[model samples]
Target: MKARFPDRAKLRAQVWNAMDNNPGTRMPAFGKYQALSEAEIDAIVDYLYTL
Candidate 1:
């Protein structure tokens, strides 16, 4: 719920894959979460699910 529109499960997966640098995943490898720690990514992903 950090943004005006909350991220859906699909969107969350996109972000997750990008962070994991998995080009074969659902979304493209945007690498947005590359700079974040694994713990931070987990926390954010968990929050997104709650939204």
Candidate 2:
């Protein structure tokens, strides 16, 4: 399963971009997360690995 996302940096960027820009019609934009720092985003990515 972990092989699905081998690049942490790319995954982080995807997460950031998704939040920065609306991904699609159904997924709401998480623009509010723009206030979060890079470290915070990294933490979020790290936490995601646990799931």
Candidate 3:
């Protein structure tokens, strides 16, 4: 099967952007998450790799 997120860096960027920007209809903008730092976001991305 095709991969959901083939590029980790791209995925991280998308996630960070989604925090303030609306990605799509399925998910709403999570502006509150903007408080998270780049390191925190990287940690999140690292966790996602496990899934």
Candidate 4:
């Protein structure tokens, strides 16, 4: 979710935090992503930034 926003690091951190918090159906639970490693998460974040 690319936005006109300036802080990619902050945005990335928010995503990571949300994943850790597991906020139910409001977003996907991070546990479903246990198979993914930190590098995979970084790659996903990088791709989102390109949008």
- Index of the highest-TM-score prediction: 3
Put down candidate 2 lDDT per residue, 1-51, tens digits, no spaces.
147668776667656666433446453323335656777778888987777
* Error of model 3, residue 8, in angstroms: 1.1
Distance (Å) between predicted and true CA of 44, model 4?
A: 0.6
Q: After superposition, which runs of candidate 4 have C-alpha atoms over 4 Å from their true positions?
A: 19-25, 29-35
- Model 3: CA > 4 A from native: 19-33
- Poorly placed runs, candidate 2 (over 4 Å): 19-33
- Candidate 4 structure, TM-score to reference: 0.50
TM-score of every candidate relative to the true structure: 0.40, 0.58, 0.60, 0.50
Candidate 4 pairs with clashing backbones: none
Tens digit per residue, CA lDDT, model 4, 1-51: 656536776555545555544445366433345645667767877888888
List the candidate numbers ranked by TM-score, top first: 3, 2, 4, 1
lDDT of 1 by residue, 11-44 (tens): 5555546544465666544336465655666677
3 against 4, candidate with superior lDDT: 3
- Looking at model 3, residue 15 earns an lDDT score of 62
- Per-residue error for 23 in candidate 1, Å, reads 6.3
What is candidate 2's local distance difference test score? 0.62
Cα lDDT of model 3 by residue, 1-51, tens digit: 017778786677666665333445354232235657778778878888888
